[model samples]
Target chain A: MEIQYILEIIGTVVFAMSGALAASERDQEQDWFGAAFIGFVTAIGGGSLRDIMLGSYPLVWIQDVTLLYIIIGAVVLSGVFYKWLLKLRRTFLLFDTMGISIFTIVGMEKALSLGASPEIAAIMGMFSAVMGGVIRDILTNEVPVLFRQEVYASACLVGAAFYLGLDYLEVERNTNFISSVLLIACIRLIAVKYNLSLPKFNRQQRQP
Target chain B: MEIQYILEIIGTVVFAMSGALAASERDQEQDWFGAAFIGFVTAIGGGSLRDIMLGSYPLVWIQDVTLLYIIIGAVVLSGVFYKWLLKLRRTFLLFDTMGISIFTIVGMEKALSLGASPEIAAIMGMFSAVMGGVIRDILTNEVPVLFRQEVYASACLVGAAFYLGLDYLEVERNTNFISSVLLIACIRLIAVKYNLSLPKFNRQQRQP
Candidate 1:
């Protein structure tokens, strides 16, 4: 399998797991449905938004049925293995970090290929990497994690910058993609492990 | 004030009232916040979605602060006048129909101005006119009214077609816009009065 395809599958599984975890936490009768919905949104929402924004024809998932089946399968499996997932939260986080890293790079590449400027491409990458989680949070009535002071979007931005740098250096495409993904995954994993986050806005009055 | 702008304001108010009503039915402690969230979604979600899809800068309400104030005010007023709103449901429906009419034409015009093809422009118009209500429904945990074999999206599509037909005939802009709005409002009101609806899809059959 192509490396990008492999990365996408990993991302899909991680996203589905996060959704299942969230649904289980809700502790409601609609747990299964909610988990499935969240999982579907987490797996496809970002790409769907990107396609709409870019005016891409026949949206990505619409063109590929495998994505739909994968989302469904992952959600069901995760729900059934809920206890196992609870014990492996750290493992899930690692996968999630890796997923977001690969997704950010893929988003940037797609946007650039569609002729967006670098700034817009970077923004698109961040949106694609985080929008699913944002939508999932909103649906679950939680303030989206993105709204909190976090390194989430910043991580995507830094990764995008690194990718752009490699491009400017005329790096080979496959090597550049791999390097960018690894850099983002490493940064994200370390940040999570250390509980590193962006500084919150200072709301106190300041003297000149 | 432009008639379109006037209708848009009316639409926002009517949609806000409907949202508040739905939220109130939930019997929750955060009913006020729920109402406000729904009201805001009903009032502005479609336009926000449209702007995002079109890559427009400074999303409509984000540019116009007054829209936020209006929705907030509406939510508060609705909460205070819940009994009165029950009595005015029919009047609210009329306002909503008018709002949808104006929005359908406005959305089509915006799409055309943005250089979208006619078919895409028509679809955008329909989407912009009905998507707010769809989002409101989803958030409230109700199935969207649009997909229920309703004449909702059809009304917008008809109005868009009317506008395009008049434009093709070289009619005056204001005349075309007004005629299209009136046509849509009349059709929608008639549909509501008679409980008219499109044919529902059978699970065993494909949509024609």
Candidate 2:
């Protein structure tokens, strides 16, 4: 439990930094408040949506004020390290990938604990990993990268299915958790490294 | 209670139509499925967010399957009347205005019932009224019209405040409901007719 909590904290911090970086890089006119707001949303949006869908109360952040301060600190630190962070784009992507992996497992576990079906849990898990970026893209007035990017949500989904399958076989909890997270992270990294992407929907060729 | 239910149904239908129309008018390549999906999100996004925030269980649409069919019907009808709907833009705007007003009061009352504070309730009301459109704008890859448009959200806020004040003053519930909804509708219609809007935040003049 303690390890899970620490992992969640790390994921939240990384997500916050990514969000701040995204906002800062998007528009020259964006102010500190704008960056911070976007960062906060990007970090919390996915989990909040998952909790809401699962009918959980006193959202994770609301339950722990420490998480709020952590997010604030993360956002501010991102702002302070703005140029340095931008220069370390590869490192940032690594952390973002790790964050998504952690969030996916966390969300899937939470939904399962809430008695949600495996299918719903799997979908919610992917949503937990990706919806923040999706909301961030929406806020930034761009098509969600989830819809266009290489092997993001699908990676989460595949990892979730693996976890569920292992759990059904009575695998040890921590082993299942770590293995699933690693699987997602590896898939995302490989996809990005290889410049792999799903085929796009051919809008023009589709029957109208 | 029956009257409120009827009003909510009306609001849902109008919101669904607006969403479908928005999707259809935005991109020529948008297919029927795309338009319906966008419409469903736009119609349910605000209310679902509000319910989640308030820790309300069994989301409105989830509990009432009838609402699902209603939204689908509304979306399909909008597609069928696509050309006519565009031509009757003014009429559509009026319905949208009416939809916002009804959603505001309904959201505020629900928040109050869920034991939220007046301030949260008021803000949630505004959110319920405008968030669907905000989400729609986001999905459509536009800056939320809420941030740029006329006195739309502000009108909802004002009307929510009026409803709360009336409730405090022990006004009859039905009277308070009708009056607040009308107040919001009027304010919105007037704002649109006169092309009035709040002042924009001057990003350049501020300190970095």
Candidate 3:
């Protein structure tokens, strides 16, 4: 199996868990259907948008029922360990960071393979890393974390650029892949630990 | 020109206006870029989702850059008349209603032409009519109007079903088209005027 394919599978599982955890955290109790729906969407939202934007057909979940099953299993596990999982905030962060890093590389590669310009592929990578969380935040009626303070999508974009640069330099594929993922994860983790954030737009404050 | 084609252009314009209006209504005064971005997304979001799901290639906006220009034009107009537009809530509602009705039929027809099943086509129609607004609301950090009190997407779904049934019975194409659009519009207007809504899922209320 291709290394990218393995990363994608890992990303899918972590995304599913992240989504389920988010659903469970909402004030309103989600029934099985609601939890499962959110989980499925959160796992697939970014990649589906990337595919759709790229005009790639047969959505990943639609083409592979196994992914659907995996999402369901993740949701079930979340429900079973709801309390324990909620207490594991650090664990949730770890999985989410891992998910984004893996998805960024996978999405960038997919876009490149489909002949998208490097710039466009880098954007696709960022979209894949963060759009799922954005959609999840939207569904839960929260301002998307993407728009909030802290290095999030920026981390993905920087990692994607690094990966592209390394590839351009003809680095070994495995070394490039592993380093790119680690770069994103480390950037995100360090940013969060240090409370670092990108500057907000300095729009003049006007009374509503 | 086909009547549906005409209606679609009209829908596009109105949807763009609706999106710009929504962005303007947010508490923060949006800069031109912010307003234009929201307008563009609200104009194309539903149709794009439907096309993507159906594996339709070359997204409408991408295939015809004219739509992008139109959305930008609408955004500029909205900015010019922001205060005046805000005061004309009924005008906004009228345009929004018209936009959804037209988009519903256009999306359903597009899906059917692409060989989607009637059930799936109906869903695509609802997505077309309401997903833009849903996305707009999400971006603005509100629970979507579709989930709030009032028949929104439901009205679109009913009209889509009515159109399909009429087609099944060999009704004249123009007649079916006009009637379906009118049906959705009337249902939506009446439901909003009378403050009607679908029943909420009566999940047991649990203390958070």
True contacts kept of 1: 0.02
Clashes of each: 0, 0, 0
First chain TM-score for all predictions: 0.92, 0.94, 0.94
| TM-scores vs. true structure, each candidate | 0.57, 0.60, 0.60
Best by lDDT: 2
For model 1, name the residue pairs that clash. Answer: none
lDDT of 3 by residue, A111-208 (tens): 89887767668868988888898898888877777656357788898999999999999999889989999999999999999997663222335685
| DockQ metric for all predictions | 0.05, 0.15, 0.15
> Worst 10-residue stretch by lDDT in candidate 2 chain A?
A23-32
> B126-199 in candidate 1: lDDT tens per residue?
76788788788778776555544366778888889989988999999989988999999899899889987653
lDDT of each residue in A1-208, candidate 2, tens digit only: 9999999999999988887777455544454545665677899889989988887887776556677678889987887777788789899889999999999999999999999999999999999999998988887777787877869999999999999999999999999999999999999999999998777656476576
Structure candidate 2, residue pairs in collision? none
Candidate 1 chain B has its poorest 10 consecutive residues by lDDT at B199-208
| Tens digit of per-residue lDDT, candidate 3, span B1-208 | 4767677877887888777777456545444544655677789989988887887877777566667677778888877777787789778887789899989988999999999999999999999989998888887787787877468888999999999999999999889989999999999999988887787668787899
**In angstroms, how far off is B87's CA in candidate 1?**
9.5
Off by over 4 Å in 1: A26-29, A203-208, B1-17, B23-134, B137-208
